[model samples]
Target: MSTSSPMRTVLVANRGEIAVRIIRSCRELGLRTVAVYSDADAGAPHVRMADEAVRIGPAPARSSYLDVDALLGAAKASGADTVHPGYGLLSEDAGFAEAVGAAGLTFVGPSPEVIARMGDKVAARAVADGCGVPLPPGTGTLTAGQAAEAAAGIGFPLVVKASFGGGGRGMRVVGSPAELDEAMAAAGREAGAAFGRSEVHLERYLQRPRHVEVQVLGDGHGTVVHLGDRDCSVQRRHQKLIEEAPAPGLTPELRSALSEAAVTLARTVGYVGAGTVEFLVLPGTSEFFFLEMNTRLQVEHGVTELVTGLDLVALQLRIAAGEPLPFTQDEVRISGHAIQARIAAEDPWADFRPAPGTVSTLELPLGPGIRNDFGLAAGGAVAPEYDSMFGKVLAHGADRDSARRRLVAALGELRVEGVPTTAPYLRTVLSSASFTEARHDTGSLERDWTPDPADRPGAPSGTAETVETPTVSSGTIRRVRIATDRGPVEVAVLGRAPRSGASASPSRRPGRESAAPGASGPGGAGAPPIAPMDATVVAVRVEPGQEIAAGEVVAVLEAMKMEMEIRSEVAGRVAEVLAVPGGPIAAGSPLISLT
Candidate 1:
């Protein structure tokens, strides 16, 4: 590969906001862009933003985004010379990279061999060790017998993590030997569902470690540089909620060391394109350990872009085109501070359950230093078939405090009716002392954050309603009624019917209604374990005649990328199982009957 040839057209092998973001960059660079979408994204914003759009497959990722052959076919059909895989959904698949190159199209990422080496957690640890990078006490992929044998040395309170896949999927913490089996089993199931691999390994679990990561960029010409660091400490179940650039409160020496380590690891593997090298910083200590390397653009790359004043997507395209580094390490400078809050279609009050439906009205905040990356349009449907995140709000300012203040203000101004979001919760996080003081860790949300009832529908927090004023707005939502006398209306009521070109109402979907004559618990006494929210039953772990304990997991329901276990309400024989795996169920629907 050489920089002599020009990249004529780039096909974004992804969907949603990232795809639109890439297209915007390509457009600015005077390069043509193509978009690929599944059946669910036929009318998506990315499709309309591209020079050309192609429908690859059905709604599921396996059939579309993750289908390497299909993506290559799309590139060929659209005459695209390059493919940009926005984060997640097979972005780090080495096989996909190889196939794209074999099809005579650039993958816009690291080489296939490098991707494989870094994508595998077991192999990545070896790479880090060879490069003299600090690593945690961990083992490679282990069989059940090997895991049991190694558990003795690793000790208790270790984590079983899937060797493939990220986003906290397929990870479980075992506090003692008694919990190892169940943890391993659960991790395997989640890993298999997320990455099609169940292989897991053990690592010493650090208590409340800061999830800091360095952004690294490398050219094929052996130039690897760091773009500062980000603190993604605010999280729930391993999923990042808020991320900020420059990792506030890091000593100069420690920050330099972390950046140097990231660059060292990137250069070691001859990495190309944009990537993230994550580290776990011990609480109240300067010590840090290698966690994992994301071999593609990260979800929070926007915050980095805002702070560094660079177009990462543009840089990735140039790198894949075999261009040399445009600037030296010293030239890469960071200015101001930036923070990003992920807005997902989930109800924080209801255990963060998925809140999928049509967006009848969508109003994003607008102001200086505020950036909103989104995918949903007016009347757009938020389908349950994909990730729950629909958008992100990024704020930038001259300092950390200013950035935090701007982010909080932007969140308050954002309004997306018809489906509940994590907006209110994110606001609370930004205002919390832990976050404001930069003292939060990865476990901050789980330990200190709790959903407020006022954030939910029908629960107005600090508002005094007198007269409601109605006005029709353009786009998806036509009318918005605002309370005149208000001290901040916290809750958002459900929106009305679809405006136009929107999918059928989520309420009309089959099996979305509660089953009549709800089954009773043991001894014909209490109510059965009803579904907490609308979700698809992914698995059933119990049989009709099996005797179950009160807290035993009977079934697992998946919604908004989080798995909710349905436990037996009583200790008795399973009288009946009403839900089937892969079947859709509504809130209040019974999952099992015990007697």
Candidate 2:
């Protein structure tokens, strides 16, 4: 094994909460930190917190965060000797890691060869099979025709997953053969857009499995140790929403097996720095299968830190600087329970649609056992160009129940205005009976849970506050906050109530004007189909005169890298299809006119 050179300065080649998180660790280690940002994040908290900041490019991720040349240039100009790809963007890109090494800068991760080998799911499966790690039955990368034939042999209820990349972006679950073609096409498109590679493969879909993962660290000196495990089954749309440490309700034997498997894989790959090996645990059985390994620090690494009392980022920095393992597996210990809830700018009632807006009011919870790692502040903007998640709220306690309750209390104390957030919805999940009993699996949230009616969109809760200010025009506009039996509700009195007798038109929500002259009311027949949020049109599946039934997808929109199907709310004949693929669209802009 080759030793890396000493590192004095590090450049965080990412943005948002992860950047801020890496910067914090660098500060503690007395290492200079440089932050790179796009035009959209000039005033972000990470930029201000870093020792120095650089402007890479425009707001689009392709132009800034994922641009390898831009990141290397920023590292060179900022006098950074090391580059830390924090969990997303080009974090797992083998090309980026190789580029950093070619530029004579240390990449704070495993070698490029390891990244490439493990990044491809098909190849990783072979590696696991060789190591005697359990793996699900799956096929290698396939073309469209080959995939169709393979699906028949593999049978129905299979998963189509991108060969490269993680984060649930290019994944689709098909229950029958009829859905295979469309699912494959959509998955390929998403994979191509997110990662440079679009190749995909098939795997047997597990039913109601628990998403569990083991956190492992290596020092490249033939030393690898597992830092316990995490349960991330509380998910929506296949993305994890809540995570807990020590993976509550795991038997000692199963936990030991998972750790041993993770350590074995890391040793086989000659892994270095922080990484996670994920697995799917079959409910009511001891069967578990390897999912994939993340080559960088995970988003839920903090949960491991809370339970193990180790600063994983600090360890990553030390390992990159050619330090040997300071402690062995026998010395590692786990204590206390920790739960992390992701706070994203999305509306749960609107199918978790991305809701981007300026932060008008920001109040994070503070107390014993509560930690908030936030990226935005009051007056900061949650831009539509990136991931909707801006922060995480974590709670630690003596045990699982205590930790869960503390997290629930912390979420209740949290407040974010100006944009819809997942806080209320997350609070509901944490308090649910399934969660309390540790009976919730990966599919429970989508299949068994629904948001409380009080937390629905436009429904007033006790915590709801006026988020927008009415603009003063020629006519008087009055804003009032009334205390209601449910909660406090805000109302805008437009134009002095129409002078007590003159015919008045129904007031519309601020900034939401009718898209067309003859458009019907919201969700009614003959209404023009409007964009639910700011996004890019990925495809238009409808044309003029095409008949569409309610709940039928008319188009697909890409926002924050997540694809959302734009479904018609009422049955109607399309009068005109206004959406063009690859075009930018704003919330409430008409996409299709229906008659």
Give the root-mean-square deviation of each candidate in angstroms: 7.4, 6.4
Model 1, range 1-595, lDDT digits (tens) per residue?
2335679899999898899999999888888999999999999999999999999999877888888888888898889988898887878888888888898888889999988988899999999999888888889898777877788898878999999878788898888888888778878877877777788999999888999999999998888999999999988878898999989888888899899999999998888889999999986778999999999999999999999999999899888888887989999899999999999887675556566777767899999999999987878878777888989999999999999999999999998777777987899889989889988888888778876665544453333321122325422211111111111111121223221122222231221111112223211235455554466787888888988876677778776555677765457888888888887776445677667
TM-score of 2: 0.90
lDDT of 2 by residue, 276-376 (tens): 99999987777899999999999999999999999999899889888887899999998999999999987675456566778778899999999999998
Number of backbone collisions per candidate: 0, 0
Query: What TM-score should be assigned to candidate 1?
Result: 0.87
Candidate 2 scores a C-alpha RMSD against the true structure in Å of: 6.4
lDDT for model 2 comes to: 0.82
Q: After superposition, how far is residue 183 of candidate 2 from its true place, in Å?
A: 0.5
